[model samples]
Target: MQLAIGISACLLGQKVRYDGGHKASEFCLSQLQPYVRYQAVCPENAIGLGTPRPAIRLMKKTQGDIHLVQVSDASIDHTDAMHQFTEQALPAMSALAGFIVCAKSPSCGMERVRLFNEQGHQLGKAGVGLFTRQLMQRYPWLPVEEDGRLHDPMLWENFITRIFACHDYQQLCREGFSVGALVAFHSRYKFLVMAHSPSAYRELGRLVAQAKLFEPEELKQRYLQDLMHALKQACSRKTHANVLQHLQGFFKKHLSSKERQELSSLIDRFRLGHLPLMAPITLLLHHLSRFEHPYLAAQTYLQPFPEALGLRG
Candidate 1:
């Protein structure tokens, strides 16, 4: 299925910035564009700003209020215009599985955009871009990423994984929401949830167990909210190691002593940061090829994204 992703038009190489220059990302253009579809937008341009026009900045007011106004003169406010654009843009963006925003932009930055006081003193990168803040508030469960953050391997993989999962979940909703479908979906994500947050795994299991108590709509909302929140927690080396060890348990009866020793050693090395995560996972996949562990083989954590993406490697 094609996953529709919202992207800052400038990052997608669209000439929509105030300077008439785009902040294009080669990785995004070359690697990611092929896997997912795009819905590029420029909030500034959406607010009737012309190319090569005046630059804007987020100005801070008393009581920590922030406003989007002209960088040269804060008297010229565009906050309401941007808000109106976001409201009008929501319907078109309702189908998007994810969003990739330009970093540190006054209109689209996801976080830490520069803030200025009324007197022109710098506050810090503590403000979220107005349009992006509204977008996220409107769709709290959508996976959002910055073009700059996509440079990091882990963050890139996590972002892609989330969007893919969100797409799948939304598709399931379109088909129908049955308790059985929810169970199957949760089953696939078992190890993934564990690797990210074990507590979430337990909580999700309990919620699924009692799924019948809530209405279908209520259950979908509650379960998806918790699931997305769990996925938001970055999976650390320790947590990854724990999940790897859990996978190792499935092959205990199938693997020889030598194979077990080799696997354990690899896991130890990965846990110690001596190797990338691809090492132990590759070995596990190799073992699964010969071994018949259906449960372990079905876990999405092992292959979250397309192998051609080579995110783990």
Candidate 2:
């Protein structure tokens, strides 16, 4: 629904890379465009390094400090400048639901940007890009993903779901936070959270149960942190199967024994990887539409992101 996302300009097809090339993601253009309004920024451009400029690299010193240095001149560094830009950018990105960064770039890669020694020898692919490192540290609750990683189904789905969940939390801030609201929000996301981290599922439930004991702002802060952290852990087929079984229990009175058997079979096929998650989810939704199970119907696990994105598929 036009959720605003902060994205690397290059990933959105802007020519902001050092060589003036873009690292546009096909799914972002074809599937996500309609649902999200992107605020594209090129950290290199923001730091006054215009497009077509010389490449920069992360220099890892023996003492373990990494600096964004010019390829030819290690003495020339942009680390501080990128940090200053991040200081300004993050505060202004309150509306952003997530960030999509360029991979293996000095300015925007989320991880594994190559680190080099002073002699220009490759140290390792261990450096997080300058700008993205700050972007994440400053807002650890925010969903940050590299464009390259989005090609994987699990990572893609996790990142997409986290963003939508973050947006929901942000919306609660707009709608006014209350104990009842927080509980309802947590309730809808119960299975979704459990699928990601059962420990977090338990922790968040305890937090919400005692939500009234904490100040409103404190409750919001803690709940949001726990929610995002839980989602950062990827879901397993076992967990999805558990969640599917939980959903199945809701339709017991309504479904005939044959229908129940079919539902269980679909869930098993999905758990075995023979069918996509959508198979069992589709069957569940069919029951959801005709059934009067309000709680099951309200669960976001059944429909996390827009189905058109096909992150699950």
Candidate 3:
């Protein structure tokens, strides 16, 4: 329920830039702020680069090159500066269960920052924000998304759910793995796994049932790893189809024939990409309360956080 969300200063409507402009995200403020504690950080401003500073771009290199240098004062390496800030921020970042980064920043971009040649012509989206890369490398399981993707309900829901899961996993690690924790965790993710890989879910269940025989320490590590792995495998479209179909079966008795047929047709359209997973998933989640049991409903699954963080502008 409590989460630490690292967000871009601009997204929070802060005038931290050199130019004194803000790119505020109303949704983040109204929705997410109420759910968790937010820690805002702008790397450009943090590194003593004031707002309205000369716009920095990533200089492209010819093939077989992997050099990352500052756009201005190429000779004055800023790599160390980035490293220094990451080191300083590590302690502050350790407790955060998730992050929301600004997409496409040279120092903060998570993925697909624009690469340019010497002349600043468009090359390709190849580079990651220096700090973003470091954060991922340090905490592989932490949920991190770009602010843009949060606009989509599916992506937004996925990110928050994943953050909670990661936070819960860390707690499990602290308290030690037990049959109760394992059962509860499995229940939360059961339908989700069914969508991705039913076989893997079964295998994981078997593992959890047998966890009693192994050393407690070993069980903790093995279970957490397997649990995360199951979630990873469960993220595909094919898996989602399986889960939705199963959920549909549960609702047949409750829904009228016409409604059943309409829902089935929508599911089919979703399979063909005529509709996004959100449309059906949204309806299912709303009705999930009817099922009572958390595991049997289709609302319990989560998507990987990285896919949710987006910056289109």
Give the clashing pairs for model 2: none
- Span of ten consecutive residues with least summed lDDT in model 1: 304-313
TM-score of model number 3: 0.70
Model 1 score (lDDT)? 0.90
User: Model 1, 34-115: lDDT tens per residue?
Assistant: 9889888988988899998999999989887789999888889998998898999987887788999999999889998999
Report the lDDT tens digits of candidate 2 across residue range 1-313. Answer: 4688999888888888899888889968877788889999998899899779988999988888899999989999998998899898888886788999889998888888899998999988988988888888888888999888988878888899999999988898778899999988998999999999989999999999889899999898889989999999999888999999999999999999999999999999999999988899999999988887889888999999887776775
| Candidate 3 segments exceeding 4 Å error | 59-70, 116-123, 152-154, 171-176, 196-203, 206-238, 244-313
Pick the winner on lDDT between candidates 2 and 3.
Answer: 2
What do the candidate models score in CA lDDT, each in turn?
A: 0.90, 0.89, 0.70
Could you tell me every candidate's TM-score relative to the true structure? Answer: 0.95, 0.95, 0.70
Displacement of residue 250 (Cα, Å) in model 3 is 7.2
Q: How would you encode candidate 3's per-residue C-alpha lDDT over 24-118 as one tens digit per residue? A: 88767876676678888887778777767756656655663433455665554466677788889977787677898877877777889987775
